[model samples]
Every structure is written in C-alpha cells, then in structure tokens.
Target: MNYFELHIGDYAEATQHLSILEDGVYSRLLRKYYASEKPLPADVAIVQRLIVAKSKEERAAVEAVLQEFFVLAEDGWHQLRCDGEIERYRSGEPERKAKKANEEERMKRHREERAELFTKLTAAGAHAPWNLPIKELRERVAALPAIVSGDEPATPATGPETLQVGEPATAPATPATATQTPIPNTHYPDTNTQTPTNIGINTPLPPKGGRKRSREPVEEPQGFVRFWAAWPASKRKESRGKCAEVWVREGFEALADVIVAHVEAKRDQTDWAHDGGQYVEAPMVYLNSRKWEGAEVGAMHQRKREVVI
Candidate 1:
C-alpha cells in the first residue's frame, strides 16, 4: 500500500505523550511501515536503519516511540492499529479488483457489439443507423433477413397452360413460326448504323464518354487537418496516423480548445522554446502522451509571470 488512513483524533490521542521529535520519528516509522506494507524489524538497530536515524537523539526518539506504540510479535514489531488497517485494506482488495475487471470486460463487449452492428448497417446501405436510438436500431437490424453470400433469391415457378373442355391440344410450334423471334445470340445488332460488318457479335461497344484516366483523390477529415496544421512540426511525423487513432479513440474532439490552449501555453516555456523549439517534443509524441489532460491554464499564466520576473 502506498498510503494508509490517519484519523486526526486517533493520531492526536496516540501521540499525546511523545515530544515533537518523537512524534516526527513515529510519523517517519509509520511511513516506512506502510511503504513496505510490513511490520518494523524486531531489532532496534534494524529499525534505526529502516527509518534512517542519524543521531543519538533521533535513535532514542525512535526507540521510545516503538516501545510505546508497537508490540513484539513472531514476525516482527507489530502495531495493533496499523495491523487492523492493513487487514481491512487487504480484505476489500479482491472485490475492488473484480469490479474493475468486470467493468473493463463490459466496455470491451459493448465496443465489439457496436462495431458489429455498425458494419451490418453499413453493408445493407442503411444511412447511419448508429445515430438512431439503440432500441429502434436493434429492431430494424432484427427485421432484416439474414444475408448469405453467393446466394440468390428463389424465382417463382409458372404452371403449364390448361386447355378448355372439348378443345384439341395443339402441337408445339416451330421456331420459324413462333410469335417472338429469338436473337441470334445475346448481342443485338445496331440497326441505325450498320457500316461495320466485320465487328464480332461478342465485341463490346466503346463507352460513350470514354474511360476515366484516374480515380478521384480521397479527402481527409477537416478536423484532423486543422489539428495537424496547428501542431508543432518535428522530424517524428511518421506516427501521425497512430496519434490520430488515439485522438479519435479518446474523443479529443470535444477538448480541441483545451488542447490548443495547452500547446500555445507550452510554446513559450523555457524547456520547450529554449533553443528555437529544438527541445520541444513532436506533435505525435505530445498527443500520444496526452499532455493536454493535466495542463492547467492558471499554471501556464503563473509560469508566464515567473519568466517575466
């Protein structure tokens, strides 16, 4: 444990008998105890070393405090109050860890489920069903028939024509006398312009406007472009894609102004601008480390005052 509870009333009552020096020694010993998450050593010399006691008076203060607050046990010198607190902290750890684990798993499952739903909706050409209410979107998704690749819809079957009573059944007609003439092949000859007799029946016609020479370029998102323009440039530009991924993942869009403010504030700092921004970190590195998360507007103003003075 990095920390432990210190009730003011209990602390005052426990140390009322000790001098100021002894009280300081006691506090240092408690810190060492919690930091190690174990009891003090049984040997006074070992305790002195653990608490880094330097002088004869300091050692005496430590010894006096230890005797008053701690009892010799099988393991070491144990304080009843500290032991109780350790027990209470340990007893609740498993439940707290389990709760954290459960929450992480739930979030993972939700992201996966949402991604799957979004993919299905997009494939079906539904226009942004993800923006709809969860219940309604789910209902629409459920109403769609299961789609299987490489499968076509079934065609309706037609029944044979029936003859009236006492009417003779006619023989099958010849192809020449049939009501409709079947095209020679799948291709239909051009009737309007017939100069090209050498053209094969399977030859495809030229496109009306001609084939496009190149594909249109894909456009990047305007928000990301703006952010890139504002960020400080450096040689480490390769990680821009990764930095953008993290930004979108963490929802930095809502904090755009805050991030800009942090960047502008840091620009004038001694460490960042010491040698014409040579010491400044790359834009990608800054974004990846989430530097803006802890930046304080007030702290920046204070630093500005300090620099001026």
Candidate 2:
C-alpha cells in the first residue's frame, strides 16, 4: 500500500509484539520508542531484523507475535505495490502521450495553412505591405534552439575546466550572490516599531507603451463588395465617358489640387493623390463601353389606304 498504510501496519505489529512481553520493562521501552517519531524505512527494516536475531529472551518475546507481524508486513508491501500502480495511472502519462500526438497534428495543420496563406498573399502582391520576407521569417524561426536538450550546461559554473580551450577567464565572485542571504526574524516591541506610510489608496495607472499605446479603437469603414455591379451599364459608361471627362477638364484638375490639400491638412498624407497607391491618377476617367450594331425601324401609315378607295 501507500506510505501511510505501511506505517500504520508496522505500528500495529510493533504494538502487538510489545503487548506479549511478560516483564513490563520491555513493554515500556517499546512504548517509548513507538511514542517517538517512527524510524525511517531503512532504519525500521534494520531494527526489525535486529530484534529477531538478538538474544533468546528478545526473540521469544517477538516470536509470540511474529506470525501476525509477518502477515501484516506482507500485506503492507502488497498494498504499497498497488498504490504505486495507482499513482502511475494518476500521473496522466497516457493522456500526455495522446496530447503530444495531437499537438504534432495541430502544428502540421497550422504550418500547412500558413504556407497556403503565404502563397495566396504573394500571388496577390499583399506581402509587400508586411515587410518581412518568407525566407527571412523561416531563417529566424530556424535559429531558435530546441525546447529541451540533455547535454546543455547547468546553471552553476561547476563543470571541469579544459586547459587548451580558448575560453575567457571567469570573473571573481562579487558581493551580489554571497551577500543576498535571507535575514532572520527578530522580535520588535509594538510601540518602538515605525508605522507603515499612509500611501495614496488609488493612484491612476501610468501611460502604457508600445502595443498598448499604438492600439486605439477606430470605426471600421462600411461598404458592399460588388454594390454598384447591378447599376445600368450604359448609364455608367456615359457618366464615365462624357460627364466625368468634361467635369475633370473643366474643374477636375483644380478639384484634385483641392483634394490633395485637404488630405494633407486633415489626413496627414501629403502626397496621397500623387502616390502610386492612390486610385485617381493623371488618366481623367475610366470608361468601360461596348459597341453594338442594330437594325433601324421605319415609321408605318395606319389610316391612309381607306380614303383613297
């Protein structure tokens, strides 16, 4: 069984043996030993053996309860074995193995998805905005060491020194590590001790840096993906071809200048209109038109024939 049960069984056996002694002195000694903290496992085993092998008087006293003691000892060891098995089962070894296997599968799937996303983004020319190349990312990831390794150096500098190695000399110990031992508690009179400072109860939080500072909430722009796709194509074409071109030639250039100024003043993007990312450029209007031939219709006379007859 477990350590607790084993201890109890040993105690029971010892008490039974002590009870059998005819002289109260032997029993009294055993009682004193039992009342004290029990010996360690190794010491208890040695003591048990020594008691059995000693003088005939001691042996005879112990032999009276020897049968019951042997049975209890056997049962205790058997119980210990069973407890060990239970502990092994409870340690989550089986679940951990299964979890590790699942983790590998998850990592594989993530890698595949990332690879697919990279391919798609590169194809769409979206990777340029992110600035980190895929090859550089891979190299950085590869440079990281493994999570666990057996032969890695220990924390303390206790390893053997090699004479031939071109290693830098070790620094002499400063007062830092040696002088940092814990201070022992000392009794202080309640009256003599200084009172704690009356600190402010609720000081405001300090401004955060990096990510916390940069991440501010903003309204997301709203729109449908192909919202204008259902609009009349002829009308749209005409608007683009004539109306927009005329408007631009007349005042569109001036409007562009105004838009650039507004962008610079309000949005802080000075070269927004001139930048390659800008949609509106030197080409005044974009027209998508299709030419189609059709038959002409003739006008018909509906009331002329009857008057002639």
Best by lDDT: 1
lDDT of 1 by residue, 1-309 (tens): 756778888889878988999999999988888777789988999999988898999999988988888998978889888888788879999998998799768757654554455445545655332234445556766766666111444454433455577878777766765576433333433534433663455656545644333433334344455567666655544566666676677666544544655676676554775765577777767777877644432332233222110
State TM-scores per candidate: 0.46, 0.18
Candidate 2 local lDDT, 173-201, one digit each (tens): 67777667554323221333323332123
Off by over 4 Å in 1: 103-309
Among these predicted structures, which one has the highest TM-score? 1
**Candidate 2, which segments miss by more than 4 Å at Cα?**
1-92, 128-309
Q: Give per-candidate clash totals.
A: 0, 2
Give candidate 2's error at residue 263 in angstroms. 32
Local distance difference test, each candidate = 0.65, 0.35
Candidate 1 lDDT at 87 equals 87
Task: Report the C-alpha displacement of residue 187, candidate 1, in angstroms.
Answer: 39
Return model 1's CA RMSD, one decimal.
15.1
